[model samples]
Target: MMTFWYIFVMAGVTYLIRMIPFSFFTKRIKSVMLRSFLYYIPYAVLAAMTIPAIFYSTGHFLTALGGTIVALVLAYFRLPLIVVALAASGSAFLLSFFV
Candidate 1:
């Protein structure tokens, strides 16, 4: 159907948009500020993506939010990423079960 074609075209455009930046900058740039920004992009993106989820989790939002705060503190103390994730997820799960 026409909708399928539309989705395919949109997906292709999105892929190109994401790929073009990396392809264009692979060898021509070497700025320290740019590198630092790139290094933090994932964290910035993760926060942007996850913050809303914490606030919007409906029945268990508060517990999840608390867990996220604890995980953040652990991360600040240099805990491993996996441990932070597990702790946060476990907290959220336990709280959801209780509440």
Candidate 2:
């Protein structure tokens, strides 16, 4: 079936992606710029993947924006995770009623 071939190709690609970096980058990277870039890659990737989901999660833009703002403020203040989450959800729910 086509699905089987697709799966096989996907697995091979995934394996090659993982294998290439390990096989090719065996030596220590001496470039400071490259190291810094690599260090921030995870955070950059996380934001890239997460920001769109956050904005689109709620059906309404205002509700999602309200929730995101609350979350950001609470997170900036270093509030507990549960508190931030609940407050964001509550704010979004309240905004949904208004907007």
What are the TM-scores, per candidate, against the unseen true structure?
0.68, 0.66
lDDT of each: 0.82, 0.93
**lDDT tens digits by residue: candidate 2, 1-99:** 999999999999999999999899889889999999999999999899878899888889889999999999999999999999999889999999898
Query: Candidate 1, overall lDDT?
Result: 0.82
**What does candidate 2 score on TM?**
0.66
Off by over 4 Å in 1: 30-43
Superposition error at 8 for model 2 (Å): 2.0
Error of 2 at 55 (Å): 1.9
Residue range 1-99, candidate 1, lDDT tens digits: 999999999999999999999688658448999889989999999889887777666456678787878788988999999999888778877787777
Name the lDDT of candidate 2: 0.93
Q: After superposition on all CA atoms, what RMSD does each candidate show versus the true structure?
A: 2.8, 3.0
Kindly report which residue pairs in candidate 1 clash with one another. Answer: none
- What is the lDDT, from 0 to 100, of the residue 20 in candidate 1? 92
